[model samples]
Target chain A: MLTKRIIPCLDIKDGRTVKGVNFVNIRDAGDPVELGSAYAQQGADELVFLDISATNEERKTFASLVRDIAKHINIPFTVGGGISAVADVAPLLEAGADKVSVNSAAVRNPGLIDELSKAFGAQCIVLAIDARRVDDQWTVHTHGGKKATEKKLFEWAKEGQDRGAGEILFTSMDHDGTKSGFAIDPLARLNAILSIPVIASGGAGNKEHFIGAFKEGKADAALAASIFHFGEVKIPELKSFLKQQAIHIR
Target chain B: MKLAIIKYNAGNIQSVSFALERLGVDFHITDNAEEIKTADKVIFPGVGEASTTMKYLRDRKLDLVIRDLKQPVLGICLGMQLMCTFSEENATECLGIFDESVKLFKPTAQDQKVPHMGWNQLRLKDSWLDPSLEGEFIYFVHSYYVPVNPNTAASTDYIVPFSAAMKRDNFHAVQFHPEKSAEAGERVLKSFLK
Candidate 1:
């Protein structure tokens, strides 16, 4: 049986691990490679590194950091942030990152999703959607949740799947950094609408939140950054808790 | 032992190379038939669309080279799928080493995702891989799967019971990405190298 995944996301800035609170007030964590390796050791099913840096030089540094992470970490990992074109993805994949997540670029040109999935194969392309409830509708947000778009959550997700995105990493901007719980209603709806796996992100405060994400939200995976980064929630303990809850955790 | 990773127009080949590097083994990623033929063991790794990759292999005659190689060869993910008789992916014929067909996964339940992504446990039987890895979770990501057959060395259940790993003579293939499966996955590679 395929078990539910527990992912530890490391927000990267200037090639180092950082955690942003609601997309701002970044705090330094540690070296990405070290943190990634430690997470792997702690039984993290997968790792996601989101590069929050903007400069072209920092992008180069992130690629090299990706190579280093790939060399040290044995488990699968995904790299995302500011991926705008096919050219932008080639370096990261060549650097040995297993998958690359595309956000703003994919939304701007939905064809970018088609082109990426065609070129890199759908298995390696993750469509990451940051969304918040605006006036009773789940509105899509981009640029790290700073900009809102006209696209609705469910429709854009369906389009992403049709365009060949292998997985949807849906982060709820409303629930992010609040540590209350996952946005279950929206996540469940996303899972119901999309055939590909949906990874529930944001609002993971404790192990119970994870259970809600998997059992109620029906997420194939649950991702958290601050909790895992600061040792507030240890992965092994959480996995055991989920397993006890009959979640079939990996 | 001389080891060669057969290089083709496929994705994730770099990950395999890095995995071997972590294992402290010397290897060459090559498409040259002579190198692949002479190597004591060969690793055929790929991640891409079936028809396109098969065409790439056939264009370089790597398909024929792979089919004829007597050295123990291990194929991963799409590499494993292409080793089969045919693939439902674009209805393309494959290398025909395993005599199995790869079919797209049709989810039976709402939770059964098409790609079958994430870590899944394996039920091993007469596998060249480490027997201790039985019931251990290995990473998998593919929409299509090779159904259980005579060559199945290991099996996993998702939407349906499928070949997690298969073995027939010198050709050994796994649908999972052992390179990205961490320690247990490294054990699989080590078992093959042994």
Candidate 2:
């Protein structure tokens, strides 16, 4: 059976693992390859490496990182951020990434989703949507949660499906870095709207929050950074707690 | 000697190659019939839907070539599934080289989830042991299970139970990735290489 995944996201800056709060105030996490191998050994189902740097040709660096990580670790890893062209994904995939995530650039040209799916298979494309609730409506945000786009959350999620997104990583801007808990309401809406697997990110403070995300939010996976990176919540302990909660994690 | 990794449109060929490289083995990844047949050993690694993978194999005449090979062949994950009779994931008609069906793991109300993704214990059957595949845990990530049969070399449990490894003549497979299984995985790969 599909165990609920415990993903430790590694933010990359200039090809190294870096961590930050609320997506800013960056600090070094460690070497991504070492951190990635440690997570795999500790039973992390997958790793997410987000390149926080803004380079015009940064995708190659991400691909090489994926290759290097694949060389050292033997688990599925997803690479996200700054992926623009359809062909840009091939390098990352060739480099050993199981999945590639696209953000603002994917929305800029939604057709790129279909092209990628057609070439690399749908299971390889993940759409990472950063959203915030405004006026009782979920509004999509772009450029690392700094720019609010006119696209409605549920609407774009639906469009992502039609455009060939295999999975949806929905992060709430309001709850991110807040440590309050997952924004279950919008996640609830996104879960109800999207048929593909939905991974909930942002604002996981404790084990119970993950339990709530699974039970109430209907999220297939809950991803957190600070809790896992800061040694506040360990992966094995989290899995054991989730198992006790009857949430099905190995 | 160079080993050949059958490379179609499957997703996991690179991982297998990397694993071999780690072991200091020279291997070639190719779909060319001549290249694969000429190698010392052949590996079929895949990580996508079964039917689509089988289609590409059949369309490219790989199905025929794979069945005729005399060298030791190892199939990993979806590659293992493609050797079976059929797969429920896509109602896939596979190579049927091995008489088995890939069954879906429909989670019980109390069971975990789909895509069984993690490490699990392995209980080896008496005959499957090549002296190297002893009791060990291997990483697995799939939604289907290969049913137990005469070729059942090892068994593993998830929500219920399923075949973790299978062996039939020159062809052998493990549902879990030996390449990704760390030291234990490295041991099994070494056994296969020998």
Docking class of 2: acceptable
Interface RMSD of each: 0.7, 4.0
The TM-score values for the models, in the order shown, are 0.97, 0.83
Q: Report the lDDT of model 1 for residue B167.
A: 93
Cα error of candidate 1 at position A199, Å: 0.7
Model 2, position A119: C-alpha lDDT score = 78
Model 1: per-residue Cα lDDT over B15-96, one tens digit each: 9999999999999999999999999999999888999999999999999999999989999999999999999999999999
Q: Model 2, B1-194: lDDT tens per residue?
A: 76899988877778788888888898888889998888888898888877778888999999989988888898888889889988997798888878998998776543254456556667788544455555565677677889878898888877777888888888888888776776678877886788
Candidate 2: regions farther than 4 A off: A20-30, A57-59, B24-26, B30-35, B38-40, B48-60, B86-93, B101-164, B175-194
Best by DockQ: 1
Which residue segments of model 1 deviate by more than 4 Å? A20-29
| Candidate 2 lDDT, A61-147, residue by residue in tens | 666788998898876678887888877788888777878999898878889888887777666788899999888788999988989
